[model samples]
Target: MSRLDVTTSVPVFTRPLRSTCRGVPASEAPPLSSAASLVGQQVGHFRLLRELGRGSLGVVLLAEHALIQKRVAIQVLHAHVTQDPARVARFLQAARTLTLIQDAHIVSLYDLGMRDGRPFLIMEYLEGQSLAAFAKGPLAPALVVDLLTQVCDALGAAHAHGIAHGSLNPTSIFLVPDAKGRQHVKLLDFGIAGLLPPSEGAADSPVAADLFAVGVLGALLVTGRLPSRGHAAEEPLHGHAWEVPPLPSDLRSALSRVLLKAMARRPVDRYASAAGLRDALHASVALDGGAAPPESLGLERLPGWYALRGPPGVAPASR
Candidate 1:
């Protein structure tokens, strides 16, 4: 994502390479210290504060700018992965893609560099948990609808730029809360998702893949559990089903129709684009206002009451 002009009142500094490993015996490097030695050290212009989390290929740290105290998230690629040329190229490309996108809903990439031969990414520090945190229960109808709309906007922007968010899981969708009680959605890890090649077929296109994932997310948000097979209650979600919990009477029918179509097994069956989905959702939200029938129903009603007025510059015909 591109950087917005939101002021944090902090002076931005160009991060310098100040590895904590300096002056330490080669045998006692951070690699030997479980990589925790990075804590309390300055990498680039940011001071590594603590380990936020560690994934298969990277370690994310809560970092602070030394001079301005602005907080940021730094993700350092593991040494093993850094050795792979293809992987490193993909990682760098992902960062470039985010920088080019600049979507408000996507996580912003602020900087990129290498430290001791390991590549790292600097990004906006978003405070909140992933959608995974709410996997225990379903969200209310209004809440899910609101979230889905925002995500669609982000996805639409990415699609427009020819970027494909290959992986669209709950863990990657962060829900950040602002000063107000309203929650804001930030799509994360675009680079990680970019490692995969674009799949073939319309159903397998990048846009279609993202929409399919969003459909799964919608189901998860509404049901708390994914559509499941006949398995033990303790097992995680295994199969794909459009099953969602019964929502309020007012929202049930419309929302169900929208989500089911999104989760369609065929790409052609789903919305042609994220914008299409957004329009459909907008209509659904206003369905109670007595608007026209949903486009999903393939209903097209011609005007039943056309004006009988004569052509311009001509007098009206007498009844």
Candidate 2:
């Protein structure tokens, strides 16, 4: 089998720092100063517990509110990256947008603050796996539509408010479980997602770009591989040929149509709005009694980060 080729793009916020970030590897970057040693320390009312995720851009930490004992995730910019005024403005805007946009499917920003010349955002901490965890496997048809519907709802809400999640990928789409074990979908990393740049055609519209991303995400869920990386002109006008386990004949046509249209190369050919795409997803779900909500269905247990234990907060258990 040909190794499936998947196209990936860096988050818009990180693109500007590519040269500098690449030049100064994490090891070469100066160590966190004593004042920057946040663990077991309090920032405002939140007590930093331990690190959750770290990257060139920032570090995500698990923190607890001192007064309420509520837990949240806090992302602190790397010390060196804080020197760039433009980058800092964009970073702060990212957090502001999250705080402004309210949706159950989107991660919520609780607060923002400056610490030792660096900025940090307090956000809802999730106990689950990113969709990236499932990128290699075929998902039940119902679950695909469910994730699609919820994500569309989230995109639509953000679009309505003039925010565009410039970056949408498996890693940013999280599958969070509720107390009852039913998994709910939530979007993360909106801080760097900004409006799309204007282009010659409708395809350049932010909404179109978002829908295109959704189409790609759907393709990943069903086929376990991204649509071939190339311009629409390079592939078939409708949809790229998918190489994955075949689906039931009963719903294959509808599924194919949705994927192709959502991923249409030209923005004009794609769904006009996230809500429109969601409605189409609902129509598809109607074909089969609909897949159980992600939370209700017992998906193969998520591995990696989802199974790892964090500090003394909510730990995700394998099913």
Candidate 3:
């Protein structure tokens, strides 16, 4: 048998940082499309709670460490997907890579191993809302800066480790409220994390893949817009898509210039690094704040920083 080599400009190192995640199905596969029954089962040392979400790689269930009582999000692979030896190897590789990453903003992986012929991961259970779950609307520029600043920290950490979150969608960015009642942003998902030495990448480079997406994410979150990243040499997006809605004209202009540059088609044209992008955000916030970002999210002025209306679908969970 032959192995399928990952054909990319960058090459990822396959090594284990912790217990690798491996999966393989038994003679017969269980029914999928429906949640696997483990709502009351014990996985490793964690007790399964309920299903929170699902993705191409696995289903994420909210769980709690039996002894520590710490909350966690568990990702369990589908039995069928794990049947192939190569897929099992890839899943293990991904788990190892994710474990090596120690980013506060990135969802933390507490543990990972095989169970019930499926691979599973015990991760930091975050109380936050995905950028996907929210409707982009008016937000205080300063608040935007704060959230993006946190994202920059996580991205910077990942970049330092040579990991580029292969898929950085709006849902990847989660906003959880802190004890102080302020929103804290967390970057999630590393299933397709490109932690490799690549020869070529999205738009001709590796580092730029996530940077481009981050810019688009910024635009989408700040304004209800889509594909902030520009089109090909043929046509460009100018006041098209959902961006045509009514917004403070100046606010529109500011995001336009900033996000446009970040989403430049060429990697060289985008922010050099996540840190650079963060700096750009800082500068933009300063400029936009010709007036201060409202005291908080669209709320009337308050005496101090506020507990802003979170992105939709994220009502603060009582602690």
Candidate 4:
């Protein structure tokens, strides 16, 4: 069980500050202030409760509906970020893209509005740790496959809508427990990554890039390490190549082949779609004594597994 060093270039949004707002339209509100002042304030039909986390671009607040009392997460853009009209346009476009996608494995959007000239998004609040927290060591083969399958289902739904996640890292993959205490996947920050400038030498097609990320995640879970690190260089494949290590001894060789194909540097060499990767996983499971029974998967046995109540006294992390 070696430790995994997961990293991502994806931009993250979290934190809190304060500002004031009345009935002023988002376009008419004055220059923004710290979001911390927003606690106990009203934004749209929800009241800000407390700060969950803040990022370079925005702040995430735990909010509750005034009437229904239903709790939700609210993400508000920072004043500096709002100053760029192009950035603001991208943010609004991302929101629209999110509305077009509806899947249980992906976080749900409830509403979109403005607060003191800053754009805000109302989203479903989830209670669970991210996949990043549990990636400290190699996970059980069954658990890895289960998680991969769920993520594939989510990406499949998004792809069908002609959208790409853009950012598919461990932190974006949330794990919420059901009434049966089974950990289910819920993807966060779907189109937000498109808001940032494209990285140099980045993948040409967002869809192909997403599949590549899925392969990276798969390799990390199986080996507790990224395939791109600490290996001898080899001839590049399709102008790029990652030095993937062999799968653990306990895993079937067929599983190794599946991961390799998914990770192929050439977009054309990889699985055509998320569905293709998922079907490969299913076939591998069928050949290896059937998928492990859900009850026997034992995700609760992981080092930092959390229940629906979540860790005591700890506020849930921002999405």
- TM for every model, in the order presented, reads 0.71, 0.70, 0.69, 0.77
Residues 31-114, model 1: lDDT tens digits: 323448889876656677887666556667777876778777666777776777787888788766666665667765566665
Q: Give per-residue lDDT, candidate 2, residue 239.
A: 26
Clashes of 1: 5
Q: Which whole-number lDDT from 0 to 100 does residue 313 have in model 1?
A: 15
Error of 3 at 145 (Å): 2.7
* Regions of model 4 farther than 4 Å from truth: 1-32, 226-246, 300-319
Highest TM-score scorer: 4
- lDDT, residue 69, model 2: 77
Among residues 3 or more apart in sequence or in different chains, the pairs in candidate 2 whose N, CA or C atoms overlap within 3 Å are 94-191, 182-295, 183-295
Model 3 alpha-carbon miss at residue 49, Å: 3.1
Candidate 3 local Cα displacement, residue 60, angstroms:
2.3
Per-residue lDDT of 41 in model 3 = 65
Best by lDDT: 4
Candidate 4 similarity to native, TM-score: 0.77
- Mind giving the per-residue lDDT tens digits that candidate 4 earns over 229-269? 22211111111344445677666666777878887768788
Ranking of predictions according to lDDT = 4, 1, 2, 3
Model 1's C-alpha root-mean-square deviation from the true structure amounts to: 14.4
